[model samples]
Structure formats: structure tokens, C-alpha cells
Target: MNIRNEWVSFKIGDIYFPDPQQVAFERHKDDLLDGKVADLSDHGLLKEVFAVVEVEGIEQPVIVPVDRLSGPAPEMSAGEE
Candidate 1:
């Protein structure tokens, strides 16, 4: 889902997951502007979540919920961080 012109995505998985935040950002092949996650307790299932991936130009982020997301996101650049 998209919100405030940006996009957000959420993920849920094993109890020993690395950083969920990092994996969420990796899912996107394109650059993200700015975004974050939101709570969705209405479902009563905590396994679900929301994400906010910032979209360029639109000045907003998109949101999506998924299960079993990958591990730490791949390095964005080769240069020193």
C-alpha cells in the first residue's frame, strides 16, 4: 500500500531473523525516497506488518505486508559506508 505519496512494506518470519527493516528495503530494486512501518493490530495477528518505502518525485512511500522476508539487505554501494 501507498501512503502520503510514499510506499511502505512489512515482513514477518522466524523468531531468529536478522534485521527485518533491512530486508524490507532490499525487496525494492529502485531507489526509495523515505518511508517507515505502521502497526496493523486490527487483524489480531501480530505476524503481519506494514512498510513505508519512500518513492522519488512523489515525495511519499508505499506500504506492503509479507511473510518470510530475506535476511540482511545486500550492500547498496561499493564505496565505503
Candidate 2:
């Protein structure tokens, strides 16, 4: 079994939290911007925003920003320098 560490806060390696206020922006948004907030989820954009993965040495799954993840290296073919 893989061992993992228990996180007490958002200060874990490469893991952080968005502004608390932003989390409930719908509640703190300006009246003028009412109904103007773009719902990225509507376009299925939310799926690419974050990735949940089990990292080695981590006790629990981590939610990391998708953009921060590096793509796998391209495979080299025979005779390819």
C-alpha cells in the first residue's frame, strides 16, 4: 500500500487555495455585474481547469492546476536522433 501524508491546510507542495472571497463571488459581486459573470462550466471549461491526481508519496489525492502539469515527453522512433 502507498503511504500518504495528511494535509492540515492548503500549504501542501504545489497545492494552494483560491481567495476565500472568490469562492463565493456570487455573493460578493457588484450589482452592476449581476448576471454578467461568465459560467465557464457551461462550456465544459471547468474540467480542464483543475486535475485531481494521486501523487507518489502523497497520502491523499491532490487537486492541481491543469496548466501546471507538464505533458509526457514525445516518444522517439527508431533511427530518430
Candidate 3:
């Protein structure tokens, strides 16, 4: 799987969020929520996300999973092109 760094909209569970940064923010606010943030850096398969989101109460990047994301298929990989 090839992962590309691009802006994408993703949905975690039933709630649709706009971007990875927002996903991180929501996860920070809710501890009981079970969801993952889409990893734009990788493709083909969902994986853990390692992004740094600047939240008002948190001082670190939130690490979430990728399986919770459901959205339009990612752009074709270099080899696919």
C-alpha cells in the first residue's frame, strides 16, 4: 500500500469530520469514544495515525487508529498511475 500526504475528509463512527486535525481534537475531548483518525500518509490499508494536533488542553499529538475512517477512496498511487 502506498500512502500519500493530502487533505481528505473522513468519518469516524457515525460522525463525519472535516480533517485529521479536527479528528484529533474530538478524540481529545472525548475519552469514551471509540474511533480512529485517517492516516493520510499511508494508503491501501488503514493504519494507526501519528499526527500532532494543537488542542487547548493537550500538549501532544494524538495517536489514533485508521480503521475508523470512511470516505472517498484515496487518490491513485504512483504505481497505479
Candidate 4:
């Protein structure tokens, strides 16, 4: 699948994951934007989008949430903090 707009960066939350899982994501950083939307789930007001990406050392493509892929960075203000 082709995505019209590629993400500028990827930012995974500071969460724990198995060593293998972590490595998979890191290895596919460059191709993350090429991932395809394999599935989507409806959650009332929100819809969850999942992407299928191939990672090094992993035989099967991994599925991850679209939100994990960063878009335009949000602007912050000094007073907000």
C-alpha cells in the first residue's frame, strides 16, 4: 500500500517491550512510512488504524497503531509547561 504523506519521524511512548519487539521497530524505522493499513477498529468516537510493516530479523510483518508514526510536530509554548 502507498501512503500519500510519509511521516517525518516515529515516536513510541516510553513503554516496556520484549527485546525482540523493540528491535523489530527500530530496524524498520526507515520503512515505517511504507507500512500498509491492514486493519482498523471502530471505537465509537475514535477509529484505530493498524499498519503492517516488515522488520529485520522478523519473518512476518508487524502490525502497529498509526499514531506511533509521527506527523508534523506539535508546537509548544513556554507558558504551557
How large an RMSD does model 1 have?
18.6
lDDT of the candidates, in the order given? 0.45, 0.44, 0.45, 0.52
Which candidate do you rate higher for lDDT, 2 or 4?
Answer: 4
- TM-score of candidate 2 to 2 decimals: 0.30
Q: Comparing 1 and 4 by TM-score, which wins? A: 4
Better of 1 and 2 by lDDT: 1
For model 2, the superposed segments whose C-alpha errors exceed 4 Å read: 1-48, 73-81
Q: Superposing all C-alpha atoms, what RMSD in Å does each candidate have to the true structure? A: 18.6, 17.1, 18.4, 17.6
TM-score, one value per model: 0.28, 0.30, 0.25, 0.30
What lDDT, from 0 to 1, does candidate 4 have? 0.52
Local lDDT at 12 for model 2: 29
Separate clash counts for every candidate: 19, 2, 2, 0
80: Cα error in model 3, Å: 31
CA lDDT of 35 in candidate 3? 27
If the candidates were sorted by their lDDT against the true structure, best first, what order would they fall in? 4, 3, 1, 2
lDDT of 3 by residue, 1-81 (tens): 555886766456445546666766777765443222333445534355442223334555455444543432344223432
Best by lDDT: 4
Best-to-worst TM-score order: 2, 4, 1, 3
lDDT of 4 at 45: 26
Worst 10 residues of 2 by lDDT: 31-40
User: Candidate 1, residues 1-81: lDDT per residue as tens digits?
Assistant: 447877755444432476665665676556533332333334525557544434345554555553433322345223524
